[model samples]
Target: MRSNHSCTVSSAPYANITCIIHDDCILPCSFRPTGTVVIHWYKQQIPVHSYYYNKDQFGLQNKHFSGRTCLFNSHIPHGNASLLLRRVKVQDRGRYKCYTSTRKGNQEIFINLEVKALIQSVNMEMTDETVTCSSHNIYPIPQVTWATDPPTAQGALENQTTIKTTDHKGLFTVESTLKILDNLSNHTYFCSFISADKTQVWTASWKNQEDITQEEGHALSISCIAPRGLQNFSLTWTFTSSSEPTVISRYDSRTRHTFNLWEGQAEPNQDLLLLGDGSLLLHKPDSEEHSGTYTCTFSGLQSRHIVQTKVNITVASISVDERSVQRSWWSTAASAAFVLLTVIVALPQCVRQRAVETSTASHRCNGAGQRWTDGLSAV
Candidate 1:
């Protein structure tokens, strides 16, 4: 004999089910020590308006769940009371309960049903040819649909004709291929997912790339290319020093097409330019102040793209005094010439002094010889 208190459901407390329109979802609930018993299904606390027992007998179920609810099996002996809900609806959101009653008593299990309202899939691919959009994740997979703004009715539409879905790790993913129809224009596309209870949408965008380049210590022209047809879009150019790359200069521009650097100029005619290619040009490039990364961003339609490029200014050192080095060289040469002249003047005086000493010694020798001669005669 099995005790009513010990019999319990084995599945987790919440339901982990998702589905799209025209899809089927299974709510699995298993119990212990099961036998043949009368099984019933309910939404919230109310019984289902219609149901089937043992695959043959049918009965009244809830009005909301009519034609959509089914039992996997009613025989509790087999331990299967799983429910299958088909053609789910937004109103299907609520708690569902399954009950099994035997001659002894009744046992129950509960499931929380959630109906997703939006099913969105997003895919992004960057290539030289086009930007492709794809679906990332969808539960209870639905038929994918694609839409775009500035309608693709013109020959400008170049998207791949087919959209495909792939399943990985029990989740469904889809993708759409879109090619660049116009290089000068910006385009946006939407991918949507449809289900009985939920609907989701995602957007992908592309724009023409813009850039600028220039030298230091001069005025530079910076322009950003806006999508060819967009009239209300705004563009701005910002200038910053290289030492603290985040420090903005006063010469930054509020409009994309024109930039004036009267304030951030290190010298006259020196300014920074923002170009359509998202490149920065310094009028007079100063290696000390203009060497670092410059970032450009375009914001519109609740989306933005940020591109950063490094501006390296090669500075040539300018000599302040042109004659200083030449003067030092001439001074060293003059000192060497003075030392040579002193050596030349003292060498002749040293030679003359040696000759005078030799002459005095010779005179002394002659005097000694005469004295000896006189001594001999006296003797």
Candidate 2:
């Protein structure tokens, strides 16, 4: 039997470190001059574990890292010694160095592990009934989870999640859906994901709705925000009434866009009461006629925004006081005198006859009446 001489070689340096939730990450390392070698994994300049020759062992493994770290391949005959980290965490975000030892010499490679927390983007549908939150550009698939701040004793559910992996980019994305209740005005919810390394990444709380208020007899103006700078966009406004709600005015800038509503049709005079602003002005508002649901829609290359506002007509009432009563009485008396004068002027023949009768009666009763009586006796 030929005695086998075991030659030991050092492991290659590790590079391109990455971590994802629940998914396995490979820290790549390689060496030349293939031979029997031992590979060791170190975190932050401390020897935590070792593996080689098809045997699994720990050199100075940290209790917290036990059963969580492994080598891609322990057998070093072919000069391949890579570390596999499962379920990465924020604490695991640090420098990692791989060392290999062989009869030829000692070889080592340094790698930096960077862990990124999950990022969330929220959007709403045209109807504003459904809101979708999506997390993109995440590496190493992770276990995604969601919860509401206020725990539901009845287990009231408001969130759902889905995961998708792209073979081309070798990246994973998570999408979540939240159903808003009627009373959920500006209610906030959070989405979180945990990596296999027991690291937690959380996103900012998201609100599914916005609040808007407009005074009675005043036009309502609304605006939408777009990611990045404003480019080409489409806008539309819809009202609940039979009459089409005129788009009183609109403006688009490199940053944002706005739309306004006016009382009458969108004519020249009905344009923006102020230039370059999205505010609208109502001419004469009848709450019952103009108050209802109004929606502003904006669509761009990257995102879409829909804003809805309810117009409530605030009707003001005037009370009848002493001053008003006196004013009204004077107005009525003036109107009655004007009517009598008009009637007398319109009946010219009747007015003249009444005057003549009165004058003749007075003449007969006076001294001239005695002369007329004597003349009548003579006749």
Candidate 3:
């Protein structure tokens, strides 16, 4: 006789299961414990997985679920008949039926499965005053958005180019590029990739720090701080003064070495760059050649970019003494010009006043002389 013929079985009318692509998942089912157990999992009457005679039976299993479905054998006696699916695929999304039979009775449950291929990484890089954000192999077409830390005008986001392409596997690749105008350097920019269902979101950020001013023959250091706890990461620094960007150096933690691409562009200290914080140290930097924008990118596994930091370096060509001398010369010239203008304006008014005074004096002398002559005539 069975151990529990009167054991009760319970299950929900409907169950929902969500799984990520290239990952494992489980479809749940519940029943009463009994010595004799029989379970069969199906996708719309298509045989997925079956268990009977205290063992798994796959002779009639579907080809799509071959070697990918299994029931919890150890938990069978305890009334758990859940099916474990490995390396889920997009086609495995639909309603499934889990049928269980024990000595007590028989039970069945309906389950709905959803498969999603989430975005693995987002890459953001700046070239020629334009930043581009891109991602690949995403299912269910994602949405892209750009934002600034200080919240810039909407025109900044509107003036971008975004493209989405579908690969042969029906996966989407999205790329968006935004022009970094001079006015936007004060604000940090962020790009986000969001799934249509809003279940998965990946974002990356970039910021351009204030320009670093250095003398002509001074040693310059560009600091790039990445997030903590990165394994097998890569550090790439690029220099751009004009339209094109040149790769300065590249350091990979796995290789434990630095690869200098352009010699004269930037000479990164091998020891200091890959040491703790990954900051670039230039021994002696030239004023004209080294004055440009330096961008550092940190990439994790599979070359997926994590974050970016940009530094602007300005090499002052003029010395402090030269500036002071220029200021003094301008001051002296302005003072002399002011005095000349004052003399020119006052001399005209003085000449006009003198002429009026002379005319009045001559008229007074004539009147006095005429009055005396008239008195003599009267005498």
Candidate 4:
């Protein structure tokens, strides 16, 4: 190895790449090579992969990289020696070296790789009144299970999964869905994912989702949640009945902004407001104003990322009697009762006067009869 005195010292090629753990990642190394040469991929000092004399040499490769590392041989003819790594583990993080050598000289590139875990938000959908929990953009397939506080989630319910490429990078994206046969109304079902070693990665639970119907001039409540590890996201409540949904409230975790009624009526709900699991509480809702197809959208901080759940809030109007509107029931009943009492008191006085008059007439008749009989006897 020799350094040309005339050649100016250049900065070491530095590449910082982020990848989801348990997904495939590529350590980039690009250059225009004319002929076949020796390619060496090393993690720090350990030999990850090596290609020599137009063939792979695994004898010198590290045991950890036995089957996980490969080189794009097709690209090597055009001078690309990027190593394709599969199922990136936590220990794979650190600096890597991609060295290529020809008959006379050698070239090198340095790479800094990072592995991260993304806990996607879980969405529960009710179709024909059946609850289905689903999530997307998950990395390195984790074990998804459905559970409950009481009458725990049985193992009988099966889960469905799918895998796909996430980006230009070799990382993978997974989608999972769980269908619940047991009733979710009375019990709080927990849908979560765990690491290979049984560590709690994320969880979602619901128990208090009672009937949300309300009469006019009453309160209404609805709630939603994301995974446990997720912290930064946007929560928006939109009324979807209109041509274009109108945003009722929006809370952005990145900017810490609370727009609209997020903190309008009741301030205590703010605790549950900014959290991963958000709630909507309309302290006083009018039947005509607040009823419609409502949607809660949870968008990730990244671009073009969102999870949505729909809720049909029914606020029915109640009919009122026109007579009741004129006067209160209690007030009208009191007035009628007072009038009846006065009639009863006046009737007793009239009856007593009539009785006295009849008694006087009877006494006068008896006196007249007695006087007539005495005059006849004297004659």
Candidate 4 Cα misplacement greater than 4 A, ranges: 1-124, 133-140, 149-153, 156-173, 194-208, 219-235, 242-246, 252-255, 261-279, 293-379
Which prediction has more favorable TM-score, 1 or 4? 4
- Across 1-379, the per-residue lDDT of candidate 2 in tens digits comes to 8535334544444465666544667777666544667678788767656876657687578876777887655345677777777766556767888777665667778888876544333343322554555656555555655545454433445345464655444445766665655555444444555544554454334333354444555544443323234356555555555575655445454334545454263212223312322233445556576666565544444444455556565664445786698889989999998998988787897788999999988877797878888999999
Residue-pair clashes per candidate, as listed?
44, 15, 0, 0
Rank by TM-score, descending? 3, 4, 2, 1
Best by lDDT: 3
Weakest ten-residue segment in model 3 by summed lDDT: 302-311
TM-score to native of every candidate shown: 0.34, 0.37, 0.59, 0.43
Q: What is the clash tally of candidate 1? A: 44
Off by over 4 Å in 3: 1-11, 127-130, 168-170, 179-187, 195-200, 207-216, 221-281, 286-293, 298-379
Report the C-alpha lDDT of model 4 over 304-323, residue by residue, as the tens digit.
Answer: 12233343445554357755
What is the lDDT for 356 in model 1?
A: 86
- Runs off by more than 4 Å, candidate 2: 1-23, 74-76, 122-308, 313-379
Q: Report, for every candidate in turn, its global Cα lDDT versus the true structure.
A: 0.52, 0.57, 0.79, 0.65
Q: lDDT tens digits, residues 1-379, model 3?
A: 7465545655568888988878999989878776788888999989999999999999999999998988889988888989999988878999999988877777889999987888889988765488889999888788989988788888877778999998766678999999888888656677889888997778777776766777656667777766546667788888777769887788888888778876664555666545547677766777667777777787764334333344344555777999899999999999999999999999999999999999999999999999999999999
Pairs of colliding residues, candidate 4: none
Q: Cα deviation of 313 in candidate 1 (Å)? A: 7.7
